[model samples]
Target chain A: EPEVTQTPSHQVTQMGQEVILRCVPISNHLYFYWYRQILGQKVEFLVSFYNNEISEKSEIFDDQFSVERPDGSNFTLKIRSTKLEDSAMYFCASRGGRYNEQFFGPGTRLTVL
Target chain B: TQLLEQSPQFLSIQEGENLTVYCNSSSVFSSLQWYRQEPGEGPVLLVTVVTGGEVKKLKRLTFQFGDARKDSSLHITAAQPGDTGLYLCAEARRGGATNKLIFGTGTLLAVQP
Candidate 1:
């Protein structure tokens, strides 16, 4: 089955540096989302994108976070400045339509030093 | 914000045992989904329940949505060591342009041989 794919399975970056996590959602899926899981914590929603714009975002998705569909296949989350608290497993998901199943990617582990 | 609470954060059982994990919330959802995540991997969707009091079964696992649409449960029968993983319950919020999911804290199950 086709699945969402993410690049840079793991990344280590210095605090205050910028990092972009990339994802390629299922080709036919329209709705895309980003979520994060702190070590031993619940997975938290970050943002959702559809129709080439952000549809929803959580408080955690503050000024530092931005998402884009720079190309037909790539969806990326950019953090302007990384922080220790930003270290987590970031996941990308997509769904084709309302009430359709959302598929998830393997996730990218971000570590801030 | 909608919050989902899962019970018994950790469970360890012998092989062939049965267990149930729950997801509860005060807010109603249009749909609820269950996912399983192994170490170092992202969550994989197990099932999605859309209607109130709906039930669906997959192999040895059964899922039930609450009558009020605010809760759900996952029951695993004759669980094996392969069932060891983090189980998450996520709710699809109602009346939104985007189908963003609110995830529960998750239950870590360890099935030992």
Candidate 2:
């Protein structure tokens, strides 16, 4: 089965540095999403993209966060400045066809020092 | 903001035991989905329930949506060690470029061999 894939399985960055988390959703899927899970907390929605634009975003997805489909296959989330609270497991997901299920990638663990 | 709450935040049981995880919300859901996530990996979709009072079974795991569409449950019969993971329930918000998933607080299960 084809699955979403993310790069840099683990990322460590300075508190004020920028980091980009990359994902390649399923080859034919049209919708993409980003979610984060703080250690010991619920997975929280960050943003959703479709038609090459952001569809929705949460409060956590403030000015510091931006998403782009820079190429046909790559969906990337960029954090302008990292913070200790931004450390979490970030997952990328995609949905296609008529199903409600969204397939997820293995996730990128972001650690800000 | 709506929140999905899952009960029994942690469960530790021997293999072959039965278990049930509950996801509840004060708000009604358009649809409910269940996912299992292993550490360092993204959540894998298990089941999706759309209608009120719907029941769907996938092998030894059974999922049911509440009659009011405000809750759902996952019941595992004869669970194996492979079933150990963080189980999450999520609902797709209605209006977005692409509906984004709002996940529930997860239930972490540890099935011992």
* Superposed model 1: Cα runs more than 4 Å off: none
- In the range A18-51, model 2's lDDT, one tens digit per residue, is 9999999999999999999998888888999999
Two-chain DockQ for each candidate model: 0.75, 0.85
User: Could you tell me which 10 consecutive residues in candidate 1 chain B have the lowest summed lDDT?
Assistant: B92-101
* Candidate 2 Cα misplacement greater than 4 A, ranges: none
True contacts kept of each: 0.78, 0.93
Model 1 lDDT per residue over A9-93, tens place:
9999999999999999999998999999999888878999999999999889999999999999999999999999999999999
Sorted into a CAPRI-style docking class, model 1 comes out as medium
Q: How far out, in Å, is residue A71 in model 1?
A: 1.0
Assess each prediction's global lDDT (C-alpha) against the native: 0.91, 0.92
